[model samples]
Target: MATPARTTQAATTRPVRYAPHLYNDDLAPVRKRTWGTYSIFALWMADTHAISNYTFAAGLFVLGLAAWQVFLALLVGITIVYIGMNLMGHAGHRTGVPFPVLARVSFGVYGANIPALIRAIIAIAWYGIQTWLASVALVVLAVQVFPGLSPHTTNDVLGLSTLGWAAFGFMWLVQLLILSRGMETIRKVQDWATGPLVWIIMLFLAGWLLIKAGFDISLTDSLTDLPASEQWRQSIAAVGLTIATFMTLILNYGDFARFTKSHRAYRRGNLLGLPLNFSLFALASVLTTAGAIAVFGEAITEPVEIVARIDNPWVTLVGAITFIVATVGINIVANFVSPAYDLANLAPKYLNFKRGGLISAVLAVLVMPWELYSNPVVVNYFLGGLAAFLAPLVAILLVDYYLVRRGHIVVDDLFTDETSAAYYYRRGFNPIALQAFLPAAVVSGVLALVPAFSAVAPFSWVLGVGIAGGIYYWRSGRVRTGPLPNEVIACASSSSTPTGSTPAPS
Candidate 1:
């Protein structure tokens, strides 16, 4: 949790004649920062309480580790996430700027779009996958409620059934409607009800499964007997995989963190939400899955599948809806809002948040994520290849903000292309970032795409981050003329807008 020096309030918040190409109301410094610790906690709840996480958590149990070992891995992994998110969020909290805007400090005014578009494109793909996942729950509810709908469940169009398409469309529209309302609505829904409801539903499901299992669930029996060294290696890999799962959200944490009220509150919320909350959820998920094995004679990893087996329409309806809500929570925050900011950063003159969200939604459909999700090869090469770029970008941003710039951001320069501006290096592009990014991205991409390198694919993020950060730090030395002027540093540190001090207007 490095507390970067704050950009001056007047420089960031006061009205300035910023170029239309680089500035918009949504991308501008937040008018007020009022999100408290609980809100931040709920944000993680929304992010992690998803269908994917439920399945991922359960899958970790079979990774040749004991139940306690799995929990230990989860704690270690999420703690790393907690630390990374805090670091990413501090910049946003200090400057009241979104991720893409803050990115301009390192990537240059226009170069920022490179990372922005990459993140947005990846998020759009995930948005579709999550939308499809949520729609599956809806389809289950529809068939259960209307037995007549069974015939339509047959695959008819583009590998999706008529009912599936209808359900998907309905869910897609519902999410868009929610997103169009604004971030405030998103925060309230996720914080007040959606996250807690999932917890209650999951707890109920876990309790029911426990009763059905006669309290004889085994969390570790399925794990294969392996050498202690092998188990330790596997446990470490599990931790890496857990951290890798949140790579998308970690990169853009600043999008939500900009609204947080204080560093202390932000850290407290992250501590509570990430490692603590996820550990609790992991316990419930692992127990529920283990219970499924005891009763159903198989490890039922999918919560929807477990609900479907209950032989009660009411339970099915309630469980299906809860899964949908959980998926929706993650989709909007993790997939939808990120691309909205990223795409808006690309062309702020024309694309506001709502319009950007619309564009993302439409493009998600065009990607036909069912095809992508269903095909393992495509999932490996296509999505993985794009994702390989994220680590290096993360490294560059962190290195530039904390190291190269010494935690100083010239707020005005981020929006301007003037030759004299601090960030206007080599025509709105930082050659060092490009130099650092390309090789790291290439190596990660190779690891993701090459069949022979599959064994080491999981470590691509660590490799990319280390390589890019090192290169950027090394290359910056050549271009580093001197430290910023004392007055600039003083203005940033003495900014009137203390971190998260202002109350948001009602």
Candidate 2:
């Protein structure tokens, strides 16, 4: 008989694969596929069916454009969103990892911290802002239910009333409770929250517009006065801004896409979630905002305010629930999940998923996000600046993945301590990515911020992403990627030595 193969001794032999403990198995990919086309469809509903989204739809007319121009802007803007989502989804599906882990490619074993922090900070800020916006609805609901609350609302400080604080705190508690559970709970919650809002908003818009049509407020009234030149300029800006806004979601999308079963599943989800879903929601929002204006005698920018003024308690309640759901959906996805992964990235050894997210939530309150709520212009400017910074990061990552490695990474090496890990270029960090990104990002930032160059602000994200991608590709294209799963760092005593390793104890 052939001699029995000697089993590798545990003490003498290293493991063949490095498991990325970047996340708990709770997030591990499951073979049973769950999210279908409808669920994917509902995701964008939750994102776009909110109060802010409705206002944005109606406000597009403020660009002094015809209704057709507004529609064109919305379509082009959302199309870009569709494309960006797919681009990021590929990475999410490939390694079964989220944004922060995928970030390790561009940011490095340790350097991923920079992008992680940037993404986390932005998510927390938006979370607080969205939470506060949703709280306004709660405030209206409280006044509706308890007329006595009218008396406690008088004291105003720093652009918010005492009732606003009370409402915000209550909403904050509600969010904390939802987040107390893991992300699976959030996925289910979002599924339930979006559909009804879309239906109600659509029905409401149709009902109002029908009445307006009977009174002869034809579409022509809305279309005839728009100047083509101004409309085109605004529409172009709108398209770019919409793409940039969606790009932010793309940057951290692996956070959600990690749950996908296959690349096909990822693409299916993107098609349903982005293009189809966003298009319908944007149409509904625009119609409702316009119809509300015709019916109410003045434009109502807030969904809660529009619903509140209605005499039908049932209709108002439906609107209230819808807005609440939409707000919660964005809050969990954009705010809660992102910061959690980001903080976890920072201290994989220290903070687990839930605690890292909770820490972010708490600090968000301390930041007094209410300060940011007072000015929409300020918020837009800040968001624009952030997009400029992040676009470069995404560019570098995409170029590195697609062109440099030809869309391959040794996933196992993500957890390795080996000196020659495929990812361990110059001590677990890639300086060339940084070198390319910093200059491109800075240029984009200046363009966004400086008033004279602000006309091109809408294009900053694309410009930054492109420049960084090209620069990084130029620098690192010559380096050969190591073979096998990214986890296979060479043995500490292997031929290829990591340059930046701490010298063996002097």
Report the Cα RMSD per candidate: 5.1, 7.5
lDDT string for model 1 (285-380, tens) is 888888887888887889988988998878888888888888999898889998999999988888989999999999999999998899998887
Flag clash pairs in model 2: 107-112, 410-485, 410-486, 411-486, 412-487, 413-486, 413-487, 421-489
lDDT of 1: 0.80
Candidate 2 accuracy as lDDT: 0.68
- Residue-pair clashes, model 1: 0
Error of 2 at 463 (Å): 1.3
For model 1 the TM-score comes to 0.91
Best by lDDT: 1
Alpha-carbon runs more than 4 Å astray in model 2: 1-33, 156-162, 212-224, 375-378, 479-506
Worst 10 residues of 2 by lDDT: 497-506
Candidate 1 stretches with Cα past 4 Å from truth are 1-16, 218-222, 478-483, 486-506
